[model samples]
Target chain A: MLNVGKIEEGFVLDHIKAGKSLSIYHHLQLDKLDCTVAIIKNARSSKMERKDIIKVECDVNMLNLDILGFIDHTITVNVIKDGKIVEKKQLSLPKEIKNVIRCKNPRCITSIEQGLPHIFVLTDPQKEVYRCKYCEEKCRQRW
Target chain B: MRHLMSPLDFTTRELEQLFDLANDMEQHRERYAHICEGKKLATCFYEPSTRTRLSFEAAMLNLGGQVLGFSDASSSSAAKGESVSDTIRVISCYADICAMRHPKEGAPMVAAGRSSIPVINAGDGGHQHPTQTLTDLLTIRSLKGRLSDLTIGLCGDLKFGRTVHSLIHALVRYENIRFLFISPEELRMPSYMTEMLREKGIAYEEVIRLEDCIDSLDLLYMTRVQRERFFNEEDYVRLKDFYLLDKEKLSLAKDDMLILHPLPRVNEISVEVDDDPRAVYFRQAQYGVYIRMALICTLLGLTGEEGGNIC
Candidate 1:
């Protein structure tokens, strides 16, 4: 068993698809943090066969969970306090997002403005399609 | 009522009412002449489009309203890095209603979000051109005396024609609207559009040659092969000559088949076809004015029936 010590206070990102933990770690900029962080890759799971996990010993204040949700909807965040799991946060796709995803269409005004905050609205929730609010360009998950 | 960003913004019933109003405006032009006597229209054209801008200006003028604003962005505060929001906010203070045309797909949408007055999208980048769609709808309604259960052929550049796409979007809601897309392989209609048609259970067929099925069409909608939409000049040259509608092409079409074009056409439509009774692009352009008048009136809260109270 590849068991890592539990965090006294922080968050554990679970159910990350295999090989995606590194991207999430970089996205959250966990490597630059002063706190202890561990990534368990290809961990066995009954539900997903194999998954990756991320654990941190300090709470990330600047972290945006919506980006994580937008990247992977199945990811779950578990908060730990006093060496015990306090709350389990589930992620769902956001209806509207600002400054997270960028519109890729070259002709879009957003592409030329550079200073304008990229905004997207979920037009089709069933299809997980988000269209740029300014350009009507479909935004795809980078990962 | 606040914005005309998309054709879907107006309901079918509202569209019928608008058409009725436009019909009345056409029949008795002088009756609604002073409807917008004191009002002002700001044409905030970030891009230069002669036909659309003129149509809007003419519509407001025909209603006896004043028109203002720049035809090009470089000539306005937009050249100094002012945001669309700021521009529209400023215009809203000066005008009763505004018509904006920009090169960006949703630039008008952003303006519509901030503007206090009604914002009509004149033509937003290859996106939705609601007014043009309205013009097309009015044309079809007037010419055919019907809006449903017809075979409409959309010829030439189906891929990048905003007019064709907008017309299809409006027509799909009608009872029986079957689309016949006639284009070469490289410029065929996008799959996203076809998928929408399939999802709606609408009948449609794609043909490489227009003459193959021209005889069965009730209306033939032609589009210019935009040089701007092409990546290379060579490709543009190759496809520019792809669909030439000369006398020979018209012979295949039915005698009563109406030919329409969102104009400023280059060479896709032969000049000889212009004199033919079937060519109604000029009438189509004239209808653009009436539709815009109806739209401007409706958006400004005038029901078009309160002729005496307009003053």
Candidate 2:
């Protein structure tokens, strides 16, 4: 059995779909931060058959929960302080996300414009649909 | 500060006010002759749309404003790889207001975000052409005497007809507007549009032939159905004539029914039908100029008493 140490501060992202820990790690830009991160892939779970987990050692306020929520709201965010669970954070869909995903529509202005920010606006929260701000093309969630 | 990115950018009440201004401008052109005398309009058409560009230029010129800018991207700074944002910021310094038409969807929107002057989306790929919608609205209101409680038939290439979709959306905001969609099976209005109508409980019907529903229409909006939109030549050949509007088809329509086409038309509307009193497509083009004049005045905050306080 592989064991990981508890973080003194920061987030313990739990119940991420298996194999998605690496994606979450890169999306959260944890690698760019000057802190330790432990990634546990395919961890056995009672709720999910197998899931990925990420433990970050940094300030709790450093992480952008909106990106986390937009990526996978089903994942649990456990905030830790002094190596103790402080708060269980909940994730909700963001109204707008910028530069996270590129508009795939070839006819979209963002495709040809240099240095244009790829913006997606949440049009349908019930169906979790995000449309490109420029072309109104629905984002096909790949991840 | 306000830019027209979509037809819905203006509410129904605002549209009514705008139509009133357009009607007034149409009635008394001399009053609005020199309202924009000192203002300059920059027409930055990245794609060549001679009809739209000319109409905008005519509107500004009619209002006594100067017109300038390149008609195509090749002649403009865009050929030098200038971004829409950068170009609009520079045009802001030159013109009091700007009209932009680009081949790519949402290019005007990108420009609007960075522009110091108001940006009118002349047309953006197949995404939107708000001024066209405004023109349609103004024409229906002026000729029909009202915009509501009427049966409108939209014919040809509904699947890809951005104007049809925009018109449908704009009209639904009015009360008791029924739609008759006429097109071949392959080019029927998309399910999303029909679904929207259904959700709103607005009445609509889908038909394959224009002749079948001509007499029942109060207004008929026609668009060309290109052969390339069909899957095979056989289907295109079989279905092409059914959608064509000829004198025979016009005979079946009501005497007062208005026929409107966003022009530069092909065989979808027979040239023989042009002389028919019911065919108002030419008059619709005239209305385009009037509506654009109203739009420029409104956007520049020049629509006050006697053409408002012009800066």
Candidate 3:
């Protein structure tokens, strides 16, 4: 039942983890933008219990998908036009996501100075573990 | 396709394809720079592994591609208890491919299952390190000229050394390969691998002394014996140096034999051994990249001649 004011055309990101709105904000470089955007943190969600929301007033390509990573699968993206959703899509991880996440293994040759651009090809989507291109270490999300 | 969830997933032919591609990439370096151009590689590391993380970044850059991702889980959404699946589902939109590292076993497999792109398993707990196996294959192919019919000795903490297990698993596919396992009795190769060796019907020998057959080995793989693996500190001190290979030990080794180690050495190998011609651990590190380059290329759907993948 949560709603935001209509925009000419844009996207609405829903079901994000609570209080992680800032990371997504930075990832999209929203601060540098001149367009109007709204970040709703600590919102009540029937699906997530507690979640964050993002409303982008400007047209953007797949930026909501990037934010979904910092949040969970509870994310829903609504494509709006004339103040109504024309499309709604749920995101999924690509088998080979580029430069969107970092490998966690420090001993990985990729982590070394002068190392190549670290490439992680995800092997398991359910577990979220990736392999290092150089060291061959299976990397995971490290907080 | 891109995700490497398990070592078992790589068919022999797939591994060969990776090797062949790596060889080609090494030979014709500049031509393939744009193979993955405009593509992005996202590395989502949930732990503190500097080496593995950077290697993925470097591989992407070498291919004339761009890179992005978070090094720390805290810096990313994972710090807030976000599920790995949800995170990747979202990252999939931004990146063409991804690599992830986690502490939990079988985590990468989960990520790969949900992803639309290919997944590459970097490492998963003490379970498997397939890419390291690729590095080993490249190293063996380079130094030994082939992988078959060699006396391969695995020394040090065999029980917990993921590399040793993966390498052993990989080498079993070759003909007439003999395994010489040298380790403290407490740290002998684990039962699972031992059973696997038995099931595969590969010949092997167990020993505590490094000198017994140093001259007979075609390859010597040394691993660290972490103090955490031992109960008494004195036992560690006694057994730790029991296997150290100095110049004296190398003197008995065959001139053609190569000494390899999964490194970050803690005095088990004498610094003087660095000058020895047989030392190839540093080369081992370099092979890590070339193998990765091949893996990235193949996983990203760039085809090479005679190419096929494991299930």
Candidate 4:
């Protein structure tokens, strides 16, 4: 069995759908952070059969997990401290997300307006539907 | 400051107050004439909707306010690649309130986000036209004496009719309102709309022919059926006549039944029907002015007798 060392601080993202860790990594903007990070792809899991895990060694406050819940709330977020799991953080859909996704509707004002932030607002929590703030066009869930 | 982006932006009670103010304005136009005397209205039209632009201009003029701004994107700073946000910020300094019409959906919303003064969405591409919806409500209320407990038959191009969709969204707030959607199968109301009505527990029936439910409707709203909407020319030719509202079709409706169409219509409604007392689309345009006047007053906080307090 291959083994990876645990981080004394920061987060351990677990049970991400297999191969989606890179997307989460980019979405969380981990590449922009100066920290030690490890991405485990297609890890065997009894719960999910195949999963991905990402461990980051940095201050807990450095990570912005707002987009995590929107990406996939099923993925578990564990806060690590002193080489042990400190707390499991819960994730919920955000009311609004900015520049996360672009509105694809050609008639949308964002298509022509300069420097307008592409914003998606969560209209239906149960259905997991996000619509563009400008045009109210439903965002196609790519994730 | 508040901006009118959608009809649902205002609650049922607020709409009632606005309608009441409109009714008061209709009854006593002279009393509210100079309410906005020193105020200036900037009409920023990114598209050429002469009817809507004129209605807005007339509404401002009726309110004793000055009117300014561009009628087309080419004439405005937008021609020089100026953003809606920047144009509205500049307009905010020049006018106390602004009404905008854009070919792009939600352009006014972008402007409203950055605007210092109140903004009213005149019409945005195929999106919400709140003032038009307000005018329909006011016209229905004025002529029929009520907004609820009526069967409204919306005919013609239901799929792409922004007015029809907006009217449905606005009318669903009233009690005992039933919808009769009349359209060709090719241009039927979108599933999302029917699903919304179903979810809200509102009663609605979709029929292919206008005559199937014409007699039962208390109000019939008509929209143009475009030739481009169909997959082929044959279907457009075959279904075009079915949607046209003529005197013969008007005979099928109740004597007191009101007919409405968002104006600048192209042959969907016969010019012969214009003389019919039941055909109130022209009067509906007049109500457009009153509703807009009331809206400008409400948004500019001129609803109070002293003109400083909001309603």
Candidate 5:
């Protein structure tokens, strides 16, 4: 049994799709924060069969949560307060995002200018598809 | 007030309205002579172009508007590494409307984001040419007298032809649009595009030979397989002559079938076919100017809701 301390006043990212915790870990820049982070990989789950979980010892902002949602909306964010689950959030795709991921299309103007911030709008929420605002190229999420 | 960056920018209803406006401009040319008087249009070509630039300038000038701006990237501040955003912002201060062509795809899109005025995408690499799509649509509507229930054959470089891609995206909105994609195995339409067609439930067929399908087509849209698109010189040399349309091929096509091209044609279309009554590429080029005139007037808010009463 691996023993990890519970988050007393922070977020618990639960039910991340298996094999995506490392990317979520780096994408959220969890290492830069002066806080204890426990990333439990391949945790057995009834819903997902296999999942990843991250319990942070510090309260993270909504931007970080949105980033997590963008990565994998199947994630369940549990806000812990006073050593208890105070609020549980079912992540949904964001309506708009800025500078999170670069447009990978080489011909896209964003690729050449290098100075402009990449912006994507959620065109089809059913498919979890985000389209680049300028080029209109569909942005595929890389997990 | 919206910029024309992609074919998807305008809805089907909007396109029909635009086509009607173009019709009015064609019938009553002198009535719309000075509709855009004192208005300025900027032709910002970040790539070398002959027809698209001239068509836009001619459109603006025919509407009694002045034209300005560079024809090539080397002449513009883009040579000094000026961003598309900055260039558009600066041009917006001078021109009432701007038409830009860039070798980089979506460059006009970036310009549209920063410009205060309407931005028209003349051509954006191999990504999109919305105005050209509009011209094609208008041509089809006028010539065929309708926009639905017809088979359109897209021949030659389906891979890199932005016009073909945009036209497909547009026509799929109509009823019974059967697409016949004719190209060599290597130059076939992109799988992603075919996937989109499948997802939309649009019927399409792909063939290596034009002879197999050309006779059944209501329209044959021929495209130049550019040597510039190929990384390997050998592949370019091999594929360049793979889909050439000559008098022999046209004999198999329908008598009333429209043969169109987004011109400045290479050897893909033989000059001998120009005299053929079925060849409507020149007429298609003429319609390009009128459609653009309608676009400029509408974007500048010179026309009414019905797109009438320019004079």
Candidate 6:
């Protein structure tokens, strides 16, 4: 059992896609953090065959909605008071988000030479297709 | 209002409004310059759709708006395994609206449900291409003055042509628009579209021969027999010849008859038809910009001169 030092405070991201710890770490920019952080990849998961885990020991206030939408996983944020979980929080889909991930359409206006921000709107929940406001293209697969 | 994911969703009036606005934008592009100023429009294309994507950027730019987002998926956080919902939720914060294209069916609809701002469906898989339908409508209106009472022959891969599928659905709104469906037996238009035509009381007929109805058609819409649809080499080679629209074949047609194609064409139509003065595919591509311009203005609620640029 690898000892992931107990956090006096902060969060524990659970059920990450296997081999995605480093990606998540880079996404969150954990290396630039002012708090102690620990990551474990290829960890056994009850819900998943294998998972990755990350523990952040700081009062970071940010929403990782991109992760929630990118993969099928769970994240748990806990506020620690004297080594006990004072508050436990799970990641939920945000109604809206900003500048987290890039659109995958190569011919999309965002892919042009101009300084345009690539965007998509969630239309269908069951299929997860996004519509481009400019092109009116509908795509179900996430890029 | 959340998204234009399908032509099925737009009412006749709403679709016409898009056309009307497109007409105005085409005649006077500079008039709508400030419609999207200070607002961000995001283009999220999951596939390689250069023509479709650039049309959107042109629409936004002509509207005096700024655009952003990624053309390639690998460059985005999605490669690192980001969820679609999370991605849009984040993008919604930065942009006032979005355009998306995906290789999978119904992906944009997923983003729209989670998004607060407007979502526009660019194209998805081999499914709906509503914007292309809009372009067709604008072209017909400009060239023929109306969408009704015309004999339109749809030639090529009916089963796999997304534009053809969408065009047929759109034509249902017009009165007395007869259809001469031309395609190989294996590539026949889907039964659902036929059922839809029947339910809507639109008249149509399917024929394997394009020349049989060439002289009778007021418009001939051509598409490539998508080679990707055939499993065997023998089937593709056999069916490929059955749909070619050459100028010699056009000589048997009416001079007033207009020919159209949702371009990026293969060998379906002979290049000789380009000088026939009836080929309207290139003009059709330009209308794409006009139609999209009108759509952006309407969707963004920039109807007023101030919103669309007064000075």
Most DockQ-accurate candidate: 4
Each model's TM-score for chain A is: 0.88, 0.96, 0.78, 0.96, 0.92, 0.76
Best prediction by lDDT: 2
* Model 2 stretches astray by more than 4 angstroms: B226-242
Superposition error at B269 for model 6 (Å): 1.4
Per-residue C-alpha lDDT of model 6 across residues B205-244, encoded as one tens digit per residue:
9998877889899999998776666678898888776767
Candidate 3 C-alpha error for residue B307, in Å: 13
> Once model 3 is optimally superposed onto the true structure by TM-score, how far is the C-alpha of residue A63 displaced, in angstroms?
48
TM-scores for candidates 1 onward, in order: 0.92, 0.94, 0.65, 0.95, 0.94, 0.66
DockQ class, candidate 5 = medium
DockQ (CA atoms), all models: 0.54, 0.84, 0.02, 0.88, 0.67, 0.02
- Could you give candidate 5's per-residue lDDT for residues B51-98 as a string of tens digits? 899999999999999999999999999999999999999999999999
TM-score of chain B of each: 0.98, 0.95, 0.92, 0.94, 0.97, 0.93
Per-candidate count of clashing residue pairs (backbone under 3 Å): 0, 0, 120, 0, 0, 71
Model 1, span B2-55: residue lDDT tens: 799989888999999999999999999998899898999999999899899999
Q: Could you give the interface RMSD of candidate 4 in angstroms?
A: 0.6
lDDT of 1: 0.89
Interface RMSD for each of the candidates:
1.9, 0.5, 11.1, 0.6, 1.7, 10.4
Per-candidate local distance difference test: 0.89, 0.91, 0.75, 0.90, 0.88, 0.77
Error of 1 at B256 (Å): 3.0
Off by over 4 Å in 5: A42-50, A60-63, A123-127, A136-141, B304-309
Model 6 scores a C-alpha lDDT of: 0.77
Residues A30-68, model 6: lDDT tens digits: 788877888898898788889888888877475354555
Q: List clashing residue pairs in candidate 2.
A: none
lDDT of 2 by residue, A1-143 (tens): 99897678788999999999999998988889998889999999999999999998888689998888899988899999888998999899999999888999888999899989999999889989999999898899836
Where does candidate 1 stray beyond 4 Å? A8-10, A26-37, A56-65, A79-88, B307-311
| TM accuracy, model 3 | 0.65
Residue A72 shift from truth in candidate 5, angstroms: 1.1
Task: List the candidate numbers ranked by TM-score, top first.
Answer: 4, 5, 2, 1, 6, 3
